[model samples]
Target: MKPKQTLSWKPFVLSAAVLLILFPFVYLVLLSLASEWRFPDLLPSYFGLRNWATILGSEAGLLESFVSSLLISLSVAMVSTTSGFLISRAVFYHPKKNTLTLLAYFPYILAPVVFAACLSFFFLKMGLFGNITGVIVAQFIIAFPYALLFFSSFWNKKVKSYEDLVATLGGNRWQTYIKVLFPLAKGLLLICFFQTFLISWFEYGLTSIIGIGKVQTLTIKVFLFIKEANYYYGALSCCLLIFPPIVLLYFNKRYVFKKLV
Candidate 1:
């Protein structure tokens, strides 16, 4: 009876927690859609799809920014994830990998804006300033550290055990990777790729600094709208910024449930 009671409460508590966490996003959607949501009111005075419709249409260069954001994020994800996976493999197999892993943590600890400032001079020298290619490269700086960290977790004894099993079955390193490692880590790899994409997608400081305002990502667009006191469009852009993360959350939840099942 006691165990059953505890189990029953768990679902209720988790559901409440999930809703509590998601309420802000719900509010943001309402706020974006609310044409005149004045203060001291629990609900909006008026509600319409005008914001979404406008943002999706030819208003404020949003369509262009949306496409640019997509392209940059996808490109950053693939490049960063692939390179991180390759480099992490080498580092993980190295005898001094512990030291290397410790070093990798250093770069991510700095605030991105500050890091961007530090790299600005070098970017100028390399003629990467104001370049979309440079923006990708700058964003990679943030994504790569996270990528290395993520891939590191996938390289423990459990993975090593499989490697050993493959070796025993007469497989070399490449065969082991193609047959065992890649297959086993495919789900994790996909997650890592998307995580990198999210990082690049939301990045503002690095892109602004490196691209020198030439590259206008959705994040930049959001800030620009906010700077102009256009909260409606800002909220609209905010929706675009957050939508992918929600999709990502759904993917992670589904993946976890599948693993559990």
Candidate 2:
């Protein structure tokens, strides 16, 4: 019965961890909908949809920023993941792998703020400062490390023998990747896409510094609202900003959780 007892503990621990992670998000939702949130109070005295309504109706640039954020995130995710996948594949095929492997993960070792600062100077020199393209480039750099790490694991484990098998069947390299390797790596690719998306969406320092007044994103707007003491509006805007990733997470939970387990 030791195995049975150990299994029982697993559910209990997992439930506790889930609740711990979700509690702040639940509170954030409550605060977003609340008419007023006072610190001394355990909970809001009144809750209404007024906050959501006001932001959605009155805010002019919020939707634009939301779209910009979505576009930037999607673009960064696609470019970084694709580049990382290709690089990882090349590394996998390389006769000497260590140097390429090190290069792939090098960006991740740098602090994000430091990297952003370096990029800011480069952008200024290139006259790309305060531009959407500049922000996208920075995000691509940030997201590539995560994509490389994730795809490398999938490629090594699932596709190590793929080339040999494809050669035996008289298939070329491209055909092998397209038919055998890619299908097996789909789950990891999805995971990388969403991971990179989140990183780009929530990125504040880089976006603010690089984009300046030109390319506004949801995170920048949220920070600006807070600085202006528009807590309600900020909270409401945040709720809208949070919805996309939450929906993605919900839809991908089965696959993501299975991998976690």
Candidate 3:
């Protein structure tokens, strides 16, 4: 008889790693479905769709908050990615490119809470305080510079050479971008959109300070539940919060990273 083969540790290690990564998400889902789960109970007294169903009723404004977060994130990502890509091009050609790039890092120097507070006065003066638009603008100020910096690498001597070649071939700036640059930068654009969307999506500090408890995005709702020690509802809110990022990650892996690979 052949000697029994020793099993590889790699598979077990991999499985453990996978479990570690998935445990939080799985526990969150379980918690969301649990009711009256408390100490020494081994498991919840009840588990089902009861907690999730609360979103449909007015017991929780979860659905509304979810919609609000989705809209705000989408808006911030679109505007930031587009403007960043365009402005990065101008920065690449500017004599003060270094200075401009440095300035892009300004918003990041201060803590997000302090940054929001600094902007609060302007927001109040502009009649933007405690509203959705104010939160968007505030988040934009942070997200846009990030986008500008992110796309900086997309423009360089090679890209400039391509632009010149297009110009020589009778392609105008619009045509050059439409036909050459956008195609070249499509991957980066999608990635930046995803990044900026996440920035706005999970943003708590700025949204809280700027909105002043009015524009309650999903993140805020999660905090509110947790603050009240409503763990069951908080878990439910957490599940809702994690849903979009999970969807976005799936698509990013399937469509974006797959193509890049």
Candidate 4:
């Protein structure tokens, strides 16, 4: 018998893909750490943590922006996940499941900017515009569709069967949720949390429109830095922006591999 040949293309393709994704970020980190990276320079003239220091110190409101971003993102994650989980459950069992499912995709499909535009008038009317709480509400509204779709996918035949088994075992709704559903869907819930948090974190269009520029999250800060020709600060903010998601992705990947093992 002839020995089997290995696929030589796979590794090359995968490595290229990884580089494509990571190279920009590597450059961003380099730029962020650089004090001066002028034209024609392959590397920075001065390397220091000045940008980081400036952002972290009271010199800029970045620390305050970071806190605000954290509060908003965390709150959006909690609200979107919890509310979406509950809403998905109802929609899954609803008599008008088809209509509701179709409706659930609307917000997600709409261009976030256009959606924000259409809602801006209503936000004004409801006194949500320019308020941090209002921006949170807008993010939740925008993120709900994604959460709904995600959790809706969780309630498949197998999940339903397990749920029925719990019911047959005399587990009440709360008991079933706490014991069965919670453990079963824990990873998915975490994914949803991260996704929704990320959605809220990187949101510029919706926050800008809804907050009326009053609430400046990290995304806003990055844009502000760029608009003001502060490229070093912009790069620093970019690094900060990508840091959490990358960390979460790494941990999630590790957890998945551990589970598989």
| All candidates in order of TM-score, best leading | 3, 4, 1, 2
lDDT of 1 by residue, 1-261 (tens): 565534468889999999999998988787788876667888777789888888666868887888889999999999988888878988988899999988899887888888998999998999889978888888888889888878886787898899999899999989998998889889977877878898898899888888777888899999998899888788888888899877888878656433222
Q: Model 2, poorest ten-residue lDDT window? A: 1-10
lDDT of each: 0.84, 0.80, 0.90, 0.86
Residues 35-107, candidate 2: write the lDDT tens digits: 6667798877778887766545645477778889999999999998788888877776677776777876778
After superposing candidate 3, which stretches have Cα over 4 Å from the reference? Answer: 1-7, 254-261
- Native-to-model Cα distance after best TM-score fit, residue 177 in candidate 1, in Å: 2.8
Candidate 3: C-alpha lDDT: 0.90
lDDT of 2: 0.80
Tens digit of per-residue lDDT, candidate 4, span 1-261: 999998799899999999999999999998899977888998889898888888757776888888899999999999999889878988987788889999888889988878988999999999989989989999999898988888876777898898899899988999888998889889888888888888999899989889887998989988898898888888888888889888888877644333222
Candidate number that wins on lDDT, 3 or 4? 3
Best by lDDT: 3
Q: Which candidate number maximizes TM-score?
A: 3
Please identify which of the two predictions, 2 or 3, would achieve the higher TM-score against the true structure.
3
